[model samples]
Target chain A: MATARAYTNIALIKYWGKQDPQQMLPYNSSLSLTLDQFYTETKVEFLPKQTNQTADSFVFAGVAQPVSPKITRMLNLIRQAAGWSNFARVETENHVPTSAGLASSASAFAALAAAGAQAAGLQLSPRELSIFARHGSGSACRSIFGGFVVWHAGHDDQSSYAEPLLATVDFPIVVIAVLVDQRPKKVLSSAGMQQSVATSPFYPAWVQTAESGIATMSQAIAAHDIARIGQLAEANAMQMHATTLSAVPPFTYFAPMTLKIWQLVQEFRTKGLSCYITLDAGPNPKLLCAKQDAAAVVKKLQAALPQLQCTICQPGPGVAYRD
Target chain B: MATARAYTNIALIKYWGKQDPQQMLPYNSSLSLTLDQFYTETKVEFLPKQTNQTADSFVFAGVAQPVSPKITRMLNLIRQAAGWSNFARVETENHVPTSAGLASSASAFAALAAAGAQAAGLQLSPRELSIFARHGSGSACRSIFGGFVVWHAGHDDQSSYAEPLLATVDFPIVVIAVLVDQRPKKVLSSAGMQQSVATSPFYPAWVQTAESGIATMSQAIAAHDIARIGQLAEANAMQMHATTLSAVPPFTYFAPMTLKIWQLVQEFRTKGLSCYITLDAGPNPKLLCAKQDAAAVVKKLQAALPQLQCTICQPGPGVAYRD
Candidate 1:
């Protein structure tokens, strides 16, 4: 019986823009959390000795298709990292809302990394696993760990890795993630941030600023300073997106209703709830608030910002084996 | 016959975003240079004894009319700043290209400050002279000097001040100002940047990055690092404008033809000339190059992008007595 592994990623400070495209060395350092509630349950069943099994099969969201070039490339990279050779049927059941512009891939790819390696029976530590996962997606490496994970921008490929953090000291912070848009983005993140980096005059400056923000953010998180962390993350996200504005053909991730929710959130904040918000590559806002009021908070947001479907996600588990 | 004192204001970097609507202190810092050619020939004649005379009048672009309340507010600012006891008739001429979105008021109001003071028989130093001008327009304070000038941030009604800069060394760089569109902007500067500053997640990072950028730019200009200066300025200008893209209602300063000129300029740059371009409130691009190559460069641009009537200007005299 083959076993599956699942993981999820939560970035304390997110990464955007690339220093190097091929290597995926980010311009700024980032931190994340690997969750259990949301994950990609991948079960790879190796097929062999059959006469005509030439192509790999992928069943994602009940859609069966031959492995695409991009997915094939990711599969090859994982195989090369693990040194395994076999034809397989790979299945990914996404706990995250697909194409909602959420960090679905952050969890999906992380789980895939864990399950893919385990099915191959290759023993891998979290650090080694992180490096392997990074080959698939930059944010996915951070999802290999629980609590908090910092993606370290080490000198070369070998040195760069993410570490799991146990900052249970500040567990009061609850993340209220609202899935604002369901439409798929017109451009992929790789092409999007790249265009902004090359064309934006603010990009180099943003990169350096994000580095400083990273240091400040870690300290803030360590100190249990929710406001500071939220503020820094909010600022960092804006600066990262500013590069997009300065790109030759300007594009923004904000949807039409984003402003409505943002304003209401700010208004609620003014009423003394000790809350702030941070956004990543999507219009959906993740509200940083006290965990004691997690359930009630979503009710308030749903009533106030009628355009949103808010979900309250607490700190989740680390990467582990499934039955 | 009244004498007109004209001054040309060159944006050292550029001004974007307004923090306060009443005072118009920009969210970001901007440096500028005031020259003699593209200037505002302004004269003020104080008629203390005439009780029936109207307030200040502005003849902009050969169109004469009663001054609007906005201009009146600026005049009241100038009146309070100069501490003038008598009513005065202000006649002005703008040498800055009409509707090009270059720095017109910088020179126009600088000359107004100078000519108003001169006509009032108030002998004021350049620093003292800038007080009256800053009220008229934020950028106008920089026009008090021909070289570099920095506007110091100040708080409400009392402490605000600006002064001319006499740098140790200055260069005569050619600016081929290209005009793209003459339409007045839909959103005003103060309204635009304020919304952007308050809302843009990318703004805080830009603020942090600009600190280092501005510091380096000052040093580069002082060291006469032509390439460095141009590169920094281009980056700075682009970053400054990037904030507009994140505004709730996004604003664009680009004209379609601006891209054509930009492409041609990039082609020239690839040919190894020490030429770089900077843009501000309009679609026009101001190409910075040496005076020696100004003619040839203009010819090259004309051949490629002939739609624009290129105007070549240099570091001329500061606001002063002239024919």
Candidate 2:
């Protein structure tokens, strides 16, 4: 048995659409910041072949759950690489706060990739692990590295892997995720992105601009320009969401409350606050702010939105094997 | 003295960015449906040379006001065309309901172009009036015609003008304007389009797709395909708004309540109601539905949102002189 843990990440320069869906290859490069607050730990144990077990089993949060196809596909790839055929029993423990409206797929898949590869007796490097995790979930590749990470939009599977832009951020920055809605997403990320790629007239321009966004974001991180970093990330997130709006039968992730929180963020910025907002494919808005200003920002946000659940997070470490 | 009245129009395929700001030439052709419910009437009287007035005077809704530069520029064009130079006294009255959150520029400018031309003793055709109105506001050109109108994105002053696509509609179609907010717009249409043209990376693709959209929209109108018309209009409006989000310093016109109404519309459609929504540069959302579905749709919308003010409009007449 092998156990590993990986923290979740929120993209600054988002990876929205895929160039190759079969291989899970992105059309544009992406950058993200790994957060210490939310993560998943997984343990994979290959059952003895002498026992009569036909398939892998999954237990999530101490509850027996059906093994998802994604998990099975990931394990199949690991078994193929190791040349070992065995049904593994996987147990995952998600550490994310309840009803946060944040997806834990990045941490879940990254931890699964690490533990499954080890349990199967494969001595894969971190880079190799990132590549393996990508097949399970595209954003999982970036979770293999901590701090600021860049997932290159390489032409093929062999070349596309995540690398650390900054392994650990030396500057004072904090991310506050504001949970806006607890309902399940109407459209899953994969399906929404597929529709965007197929129908949006602006999808090609999004891919082109996102490539350049990575370089600028990296420079901002190097310079420790918190405002510039926040600006770029906010704009990039908006641009990513814009593609969905331009899709045929246009849709949006902006719930009424989501827009309310965004307006508050902009209002606070005008009131001399150093905070910027970014959103994923969900309605929740994440604010990037300086560490010193986090408390004040949180206080004002709570005051403005009494029902809001805000979690502050700092930069976290890369995936690591526990046992 | 000459008086003329013109009704407002809401674009089905929106004209967003300007190719030439100086000439107010659009980057893409657009289509709009002229609505009868809201209109503007203006009376222009050229002062005699003996009056010794050096500048034009203005009165709006019984209050004397300053003449805007746009009004002056438009009047100069009329004077130039007629070879008659004289200061004019302009009195305008807007007929829209209070706090409708709708811009009356289309009706206002079209009436001004018609009345100003006639007061200056210029015998101008409706086509000539459309070209004259184009100098005041881009969309005003379309208000010179009734029913379905198409404003060609021509190269220059002489080429760009509004033409009637379908001057009269025999089908059963009704437009419900939902006044979601009464607050003034933060970004004016002209400034918003200018910023979009200057910074949005997706702008080029928007221009390309809008050209084809115009053709498809025209065909849809010709067929009296109400569903197709609504689908095309909703998608086109979303695409136009998408450009704003992709602009530098990303912005959106979607207020919190606007999104709520949109979600409600989507929900009602899934419940077998035939309705689609389109938004301009502000928070108000317009619903396009068959006349048979109008009462039911409005009833449900009002029940769901008690504060919503819904105005039902039909196909309107073109610019006409009053007296």
Error of 1 at B19 (Å): 16
Clashing pairs in 2: none
DockQ of every model listed?
0.11, 0.87
The Cα local distance difference test for each model comes to 0.65, 0.91
The TM-scores, one per candidate, come to 0.61, 0.99
Off by over 4 Å in 1: A1-5, A35-37, A81-83, A97-101, A167-170, A293-300, B1-13, B16-135, B140-238, B241-323
Model 1 residue B131 CA deviation (Å) reads 11
What is the C-alpha lDDT profile of model 1 across B249-294, one tens digit per residue?
3344545466456556666777876677777766677877766667
How many Å off is the CA of A81 in candidate 2?
A: 1.6
TM-scores for chain A, candidates in order?
0.90, 0.98
* Tens digits of per-residue lDDT for model 1, A1-323: 14455556656666777787677677777876554356677776666646367776888878886676655656666667667556667887877644233567766667767777777666888898777777678888887777766898766777888886663423777777777777666567788878877776566666666666667878887887777766666556555666775665455555545545555655666776656666666666777677765666677787876667766666666666776
Model 1 clash tally? 7
Highest TM-score model number:
2
